[model samples]
Target: MIEDLQKYYGYLFEEALLKEIADVAIAKDIKANDIIIDIGSYITSIPLLLSGAIKILREDKEGDDLVLYYIEKGDTCAMTLSCCMGETKSKIKAVAETDVRLLMIPKQKMSEWLSKYKSWQEFILHSYHNRLQEFIDAVDTIAFLNMDQRLLKYLKDKALVNHNDIITVTHQQIANDLHTSRVVISRLLKALEKRHKIELHRNQIKLLEL
Candidate 1:
């Protein structure tokens, strides 16, 4: 767990500060399907992913689940910021997508560390900027891109940089991330496969076969 923290923090911070930060962090291991946060529950801490995956989701008024995004290792859930700001209600639920480990940071200590540590401040600022850019991209995709275009772009983006192919995401997971129907994703995958552009394995999708 500490190794993951070092790997994540080392990108924007020094080892010393990460050691200090880890001092106050409570390492926790959670099982798959665990609900980290409920729709209306108050969260007193923020958890940094150390291993495995999580997802941010919400149930609409009609009780249909909408998945906002997947949180892989090193991703922090956005609900923490809302809770820190004293929001009365949670806009999303955070659930562990796999057996996961996290480094839990209490809000009060995190606030103190942010104020005192220059490295922490820089890390937060950089993270916020990247997150904002992602938000902008998601909004643009939803507003302007067609479903096929969105799916293609997402696959290309997630594909290995060198290969621009060979993505391994599942259809249901992609549907959740894209806010679309799984049946639609299945149809799209079939079309792509028929065109010899991709192939579907048991749990993985391989792209750019041609």
Candidate 2:
């Protein structure tokens, strides 16, 4: 665990801070599609990603989840930071996008380490800024782009995140994440294929332009 922590996060903190984190943090592994945190759940700890990716989602009024962002290796959920410091229930849901390894730090250490380590303070602030920008980008994509454009962007983003141009996903899964119907997603996917933006297989979509 100490070696994993250093491999992922050593560059972000000093030797002393890294040592403290390894000593105090509890490590855990979660399988893909598992819920790490659910809406209204008490957040006792903040997770630092050691490997794989976690998708952060926001629930709509109708109990539908909308994908907000992805936290990859070396990243932490900024919303978790706010919930931890506020001592409140998690408002957003976090799900493992792939099999993931995480380091959970007790919420009480947030302030303690914030004031004690300059690197920790900067890390927290930087996380907040990144999340804020992702929120803005999500809004802009939804408000200004058409459904097809949004679909294309979504595929491109997924490809970039997974580090593969070929994304293995079903149209139904895409619909669920985008909060739409499978039929609609299927139509859009075929249209994209005709446009040469992507190549559709039985259960995979290979990005061509991106």
Candidate 3:
């Protein structure tokens, strides 16, 4: 796990410098379908992805998951940023997409390390900036994209997670993600399937190549 971290960020840091930060890392196992962190909760820790994937999301008023993004290998789940900023609440829930292993770091400890470790500090700063940008992009997409385009984009993006041409996202989940009605999503999906643009496989969809 440390090797993957080093490989990903080695260009930005000296080997000895990164090793000192990695020394404080600890691993945790999360079962598939488990909630790694709940929405509206408090957190003072962050998790570095070691294996598998995670979904950062929240439920709509109708109680369906809305996927914000996928956190895969070598990524960091930094819910504690808001917590540290005194938000006192999490904006999203994080769930294990598969059985996952993570390196847990306490927020205070990470801050202390960053004060002494320039490379690690820069990595954290960059990650926070990227996350903020992602949120902004999401807001823009929601404001501008139609339901079909939004769903299409999501399927294309999530296809990488499934490791197949097919994607296993439910219509209800799509509705939540797109902030639309399930009936509307169903009608659009059916039309797309008939047009041979996609193949519906129960809850999953296989997007046809253009």
Candidate 4:
């Protein structure tokens, strides 16, 4: 696993640093829909995604959750970094969007590596920047776009991240992610279908265009 990780861009640290990571990091394989990090849970390690995708979500007080962004192969979870850096509990949830494999670096090493390794610092900073931009984009979508537009954007994002135009998800699931009612989502989705933007099936949505 160490040798395999060495070939990745962000994991190309110095030999000593690499050795340290190999010694302390634990590799985990998770299946789709598995909850990796739950709100209010104290995090002990930061995960480095090696394959598949993870969806980061923030839940409202009423228990409705909205997907903040996705972390795919070669990406790290910035929400996890915040928890580890502050020694606090997680404010967001991370769920496996597909079968995933990742390496978890202990929280202590996360802090140590920030100062000891240049590569790790750069990687973390880049992740933060990307996540922040995604948040900004999401905000813009909510503020400036209508429900139909938002649904289209959401479907496009899911398709892009999953590397397929076909998405296997339910209308209720889409409503949950977008923080809307299932009835509203169903109506908007039908509008999208009428416009030839997507084709809907039983628990599936196939994008016809962006």
Return the top candidate by lDDT: 2
The lDDT per prediction is 0.72, 0.91, 0.74, 0.89
Clashes of each: 0, 0, 0, 0
Model 4, residue 204: distance off in Å is 0.9
List the candidates' TM-scores in order.
Answer: 0.76, 0.97, 0.82, 0.95
Order of candidate numbers by lDDT, starting with the best:
2, 4, 3, 1
Candidate ordering by TM-score (highest first): 2, 4, 3, 1
Candidate 3 lDDT score relative to the true structure: 0.74
- Indicate the TM-score of model 3: 0.82
Give one digit per residue, the lDDT tens place, for model 2 in 85-194. Answer: 88889999999888898999998888999999999999999999999999899899889999999999999888877788999899988998888999999999999999
Deviation in angstroms for 55 in model 4? Answer: 0.7
Q: Candidate 4: give the clashing pairs.
A: none
Compared with the true structure, what per-residue lDDT tens digits does model 3 show for residues 1-210? 567667655677677755754777676899977998897787767787767888788677766767777777666755556575564878788988778888776677676767777877887787787777767767776779887777777777667665567877788877776667889999999988888889998988998962
Which of candidates 1 and 3 reaches a greater lDDT? 3
| Model 4 misplaced stretches (Cα beyond 4 Å) | 10-12
Ranking 3 against 4 by TM-score, winner: 4
